[model samples]
Target: MKTEHRIRVLMVAAENGALPAAKVGGMGDVLRDLAPELAKAQVQADQIMPAYGRFHRHPHASQLARLTVPFGGRHEIVTLYQLANPAHPESRLFLLDHPLFSNAGDGVIYHCNDPEPYASDASKFALFCAAVAVALCQRHLSRPEVLHLHDWHAALLTVLRAFDPRYQPLQALRCVYSIHNLAHQGTRPFRNSHSSFGRWFPELAASLTDAQTRRIEDPSYPQCLNPMRAAINLADKVHLVSPSYASEVLQPSDHRHGIWGGEGLEQDLNRRHQQGGLCGILNGLVYPDTPAPPQSFEALLNAMHTTLLGWQGHGTHLRNVDFIAHTRLQLWQQAKRPPPSMLLTTVARLTEQKVAILCHRLDNGDTVLETLLRRFKQRQPQGLYVCLGSGNHTIEAELQRVAAHHDNFLFLNGYQEQLSAQLYRQGQLFMMPSSFEPCGISQLMAMREGQPCLVHAVGGLRDTVVDNQTGYWFEGDSLEQQGLALLARFDELLEAFGSDDWQRVAANAKEQRFGWQSPCRLYRHSLYLE
Candidate 1:
């Protein structure tokens, strides 16, 4: 009897949830869930990421090999470690380590405050890509039929595979590139800077032809190299996180029309789409066989208060957001009244992509959020709206100012997983008003907990959420229009709250299933084996 062979695949990414403390966003969640699902499909998946100076400290991590990698005009030694993954033993996890991996700080997956945007991170990931290429050349890890690169951080591998003769062996492997967010393209100068591509790969830069340079150069910035563009152009297949987002990127971005398309890469993406090399697949979530018991409204408040107190201890004095949250939590506890008639919750990173519309200035000289608070107070005086997130100091300040003025709104300026899960379970409505979303996990998680969502009709939200059925969605022709539409939709939902229609939507939401089985089947037949 002959044994059947499983197709081998190697995934290079910046974040993986399989390893403790390795996740920062949705990409990590996808990696954690996707690997195990692929394993069940008889696809042997191996995941690799930079150790970020933290994973080697894992008790189960053991050094696999030491390789000398040529990078940045010098040869440097990199340590490769194999990490034990008891949760998904069928899939292997590896991490590469060097001092450069921790240039920003130990255990920091991303350095957002770099002197130049993406300067530190780009340099760090460039070295990581080169080291991975070297590991492949030395046969330190088994070769795979496919090289899967996630986001811009892992995109440099495609560059080295295409340009370097020593890495020519990688040219034979099919390459799949996943674009998680198109807005963040890791573009840096090609030459005349310490962190430029010429500085990192001097010999390769010198030997490149005009056509090769053009293929890798930033479309908008002629002197810069764009890893996102290079991978989109050179990879065997380009994948967006959701089907709606894949189609959205084919059209040019129009801010005036409130459409966030391809940022500036629509031309390249369109070219890929025309050539039949681009695809969009929705991400999957891991669902428990039996759902956990839902917590009471008061229990949710207690959890939020406890989490707030813990965060308060981190600083000598309370920040405005923290102070506001503490005061509101105390007030709610003292009232000893029934939970609010209408409860709303939101959990997201406070970036422009996520919160810009909420902060939009209206014709009345007030922000959209202020308007929403005023309307909610008038419609449901006993309602409470809780928002949990922390990012972008400017946005944080704006939210803090709104919280101070609005008695019904509570702004928690930090994230806690326990508190977030509670928010998902206790709220009557989940709000996600992203200007553009590739694919969102928060809405899925909220729906899974039997809470209907009020989301912007874009990207994954459009795919997973059915308007007025599973949840409610709104759209408009401009930002101000969209903001107004969001307010209108909120009013409509408020009018119908606790009615048969609302309960039906909630029931439909809970019944919605976005499991990994279907998506992994697509991964096997469409992405990997295709």
Candidate 2:
């Protein structure tokens, strides 16, 4: 059978970093994969992102065009450069460059050099959104039938096109706004909008004068631009990154699943859900073509096993228990023992939302790592855990403290991309205990490398992992309970992982498909098919 007819769709995002070439992660990964995949399926797919001032400092990015982008009551000169897809050169990437985004000095992308919000983030993204809007309105760029915007950074495009008469050319265009994470709504008060709307966004602001004239009604802005709010109200459709997360965040306010209430935007989301405009689509993982798969499965397992054997003083527990187990026993007698044979790897930032889940406590007075340690200690004499990432100094300090007391635990407190890749290849197991994950790429990457994951059954993990098949899932309301459940699931994995069983499971895990085929269909149907 042939693929369905495809429509031209343009995607706008803030920082378009995808993997090796790197920008703000997750969302970048999605667009990089999805755009090319759509192109293959016959969609005339193209993307636009800001060319931060420093984008070309290190690597060679292809050039497309250089032009000024008008926004926020002023005109800024933006060079539109091109990045050709290695696989599909027909697919287009227009990078809009500006000094602020480039410098790491004025404003960086949403990744925020720090976990906390930068003081000028609202202004930076506002400028980006406005630039994209004006570019389309002025007809300086060709308008696609559909415009796909990612997260809050690109939300205002839909807002501008919907409300501003000058953007009339884009008024009829279908828009898709995807919310990767609801926690960040890009909210700063109305007083923070363009200082000179009369001079800069003259016609655009005037279009907002009459409440009855605007398609999306919101009196909350000009006081504060909740880009997300406008996107939800104006975009043709909105979606989350995973089905489970979509369901959880859609429940009524008093419901347990709706505890966080989509960062208190549930009312709008509930309406969108009722109108069939809100849902979730699990993200696709594009396995790199550059690094070909290993020749044999045994080669992969042997590599991991060799890494295990090379662990410095980490011991193993066995009934025979004569060698390393003996060493662990000696250490135990001196109260310096650690987990004996278990090895788990984590490659997430040390923030509460991610890696810190290993050690952070919930209101229930229970911490994931603390509870996991209790259960793990009961099963083994000493285990090795390697964590790689950095962000949030408090979490970093806590992880260091845990490493200091546990001889087998090592924390590498910064990002090393190649080292991260190596760890994924050799790690016996991968762990992701995120508090709330929109969509996680690490677990998918680990599985692609034939390593099973241990993730909480939430968000993307729920959609990705098949319990007892590709990997195991543990879910609970509180972090402590989740940790206990994680330990329980791990024990089950340990039981099922015999010499032959493990190979079968690893193969099954690798067999899991993580491409854009399914999700792109959803987008095509929602945004273009009508």
Candidate 3:
């Protein structure tokens, strides 16, 4: 009898957000943690990402191989580099290099010249996914038994595999596509100059002839090529990052109140789910093995001071925690408010999902946060709030305005990993009031650091946190009601901080199993190895 080969996986990630990443976000964190866990389970997990130009300037990636691949009816040589993954020896990361993807500039990964009828982003990602397919199909370096892809960026793998004869070997490879967020469906018209994807991926075009779009699409609408739709139609397995979101996305679009239910791919998702092709896997946390003992307020301040001194040694005397502690002193030379006792931290994107409809235009007026601060001050006047991370420039400006006026609020507009870590370790609470979180990492990070999270029960938050057991949650029917509920929970926690019951909850959260062990075991047994 012939012996079966070892299970190997190739995870194609557009933004694998590992350590050298400018700023680590949720997806990057997940892939970083997960690759190793799968590897530990004896599955070789190799991740491939675009060797973005921003990182190219730095000598981080070492060139591994160079090969020519066909693109835009011609061919170009693409270089492959191996990125270091210190956590997993068996696991590897290959970075695809090409001028269009590399020279696209810093911080921005996806470039779109147009929004309708397909943006130039179409060409960029097509090149990326197509190049990845060709490189791996030819090299067979990893000898992948499974081809795994994340988001719409890598969905083109299915299209490439379906069309190109060079990708015949990939047809025999089991394909798994994971959707971290369903809001972004790469919908573009069939024809475009930059991509000309139909010409390149003719097999997919051939399938569209038999595509029963009217059956799945709205009768009033014409067929527009949706890449996510293509992936769902073509991939062997499809999964959401969280179970609640899996069920939510499977609901009829009309029933999907205010949430993005696969962004017009609901019908397809439902069909796929019924056919047993869809699932939800709660993303696990990358918690440090070392437990953080309960700390004191002085220790928090000392850490800030130490970090500040390190900055001073480098010849700069900027402010951080100290500024919030003495916001009035900067403006008036005297402390207006006795150092606000409570320290609350929120590190997230200032997007609609996070701010929940509170994200607004700055030109319109003061943001919802200004109003929230006004109301919060009326009852709980003494507290220090630190808002970190920036997105939606309007929200960033509004937050700056609030921080400028109030002695209690400090808005740090950037990604500073060290500062975020110190704050999470020291803060009394971490806040994540996302409207629809697939699976939140900040809350898990906060809980692991011994800071209890006060979150709205949704997506991963619902799965990970037990109300009043692991952390506090606020649930309501409407946004306004949810806001009220959040305040109520915050007030309860604030009033009872440093008490025995509060300590018990914090301890319980600390003891919670947020790590990758269980989740990886499931993948090994139920998905990958099986």
Candidate 4:
């Protein structure tokens, strides 16, 4: 008899499957990319999630099992769906289907209802934890050696395993709790967990009460222990998204002003560090299966020019524009008019972290964009600009106004993955001027499409974007300086790359791999898997 060798990893996350259905930021993209890579890497990784309403059911998404999950003194019979791949047949994803929780349009994870009563919100995730425990006990799948949990949404698994013998056998199980962001700690009243678990684990009531009292009186005892805090407190190993973010959280800082953490979370971090906790890993992305290096500036510009001029072929145009209208449709059409003579794109959530505000001309309420906008209005504009994504309503409106005023500017209000890939392939350059970033996927994806990144030199951007080699990097966050620098770099690229010198840089950018191969290897090593 031959023994089969496979490492089963149960990856617990709030969101997966598709984008925009429930994604607020990069975490959705991370899981989507990582899941496929895990399969390719030969790890039998299965994802466990609440079947938010957004999840479109496939034929294979069958009702695998059923169980009465306890929630707030009531038991709800939750149907668990097993979405299996037809090719693999055996590989499956477990989805907990509960109308109370899963009815979020497409069955996806929603950010916590902070002020609203998702009356059954806690119960919803609690049921997920219970389902995982039951799933293990029933042997529906092979026992996983690792229960990898992401963010506070799934932190309860760590907490439950620590106290409940029903989960104690898994105590020997190695748990890796990934903290995507530290800000959204799932802090509920300690009494909620106490009361919720009272019937299940009566012995913890006294401890919970004491903790609650201390939490109330101190106001600093980490009120209610959200997933981020709980996972850090309980997991055998803890990991942050990036190395720099790991350092940043320990020493808190004000937005763009300076480091403010003289005595913030430093003490807490030191205490944890002393106790043999805390690690950081840079997030990785799956490189697209497309080869799109620029042969020459003229070729690149010609393709872009065609796309701008409503030309749809010659490898420069998108598959379709209707799909790209997920953001701001009217604005997208306006910007796509007259076909841009030149095409430059910056697609990201309009947030301060992205430093998109810097792109706006602040002087005379006329931004650096004013010049770009003016160029678009000219009979022969230098380029057409396409900015996709939604964030700060003020910024969205401002960009919309800029697009409305200019003939060659398109602004999308939200995310559309296919359109983004199309734009990535078509655009000449992908610009990101984030003030600070942990590990940006956009730049890596852009590079994969043979589009060089133009970014401010900071954080992960600095780590990825090589100056004058792979892409352009600006010094400061100043709008005028960065804008001119970006334009200058692009023009220089045009002049230099009109020859063959650009090929080396393009090849270098393309060759710089950001795939799961190396990162997954690093993760395996970190977890003592050779």
Candidate 3 C-alpha error for residue 399, in Å = 2.4
Report, for every candidate in turn, its global Cα lDDT versus the true structure. Answer: 0.90, 0.66, 0.69, 0.61
Error of 2 at 184 (Å): 1.7
Candidate 3 local lDDT, 1-530, one digit each (tens): 87434578888877765646533468777877777887666677888877766554445567877767677656777777786654475677777777767434654565533444446666667778878887877773567888888887788788777655777788988888888877666665554434555545545455544444432222223445566777887888887887888887875443123344555777788898999888888898776666657565555444544544554454455544335434433442233434456678898877667876343323336444565565556556786677777666666666666687775676666555666777787777888888778788888888887778988787888888889898998886655566667766766776787789899988998888767787777665556644
Q: Output the worst ten-in-a-row residue range by lDDT, candidate 3.
A: 212-221
- Tens-place lDDT digits, model 4, residues 191-212: 5543233433335434455643
- Which lDDT tens digits does candidate 1 get at residues 68-148? 999988999999998755458777889999999998788989887787889999999999999989998889989999999
Cα lDDT tens digits for candidate 2, 205-313:
5556555223234334444446687788888888888888887677433223313436667777888989998878888888666654443323433333344344423
Flag regions of model 4 displaced more than 4 Å.
Answer: 1-5, 18-25, 39-42, 54-56, 85-90, 111-127, 137-141, 164-166, 187-224, 256-276, 288-339, 359-380, 391-395, 475-504, 528-530
Q: Indicate the TM-score of model 1.
A: 0.97
Supply the global lDDT for candidate 2.
0.66
Clashes of 2: 17
lDDT for 436 (candidate 4): 63
The alpha-carbon lDDT assigned to residue 92 of candidate 2 equals 66
What range of 10 consecutive residues in model 1 has the weakest lDDT sum?
A: 83-92
Question: Could you tell me the TM-score of candidate 3?
Answer: 0.84
Off by over 4 Å in 2: 1-6, 18-20, 56-72, 106-108, 111-118, 192-223, 252-261, 288-341, 362-366, 374-382, 491-504
lDDT of 3: 0.69
TM-score sort, best first: 1, 3, 2, 4
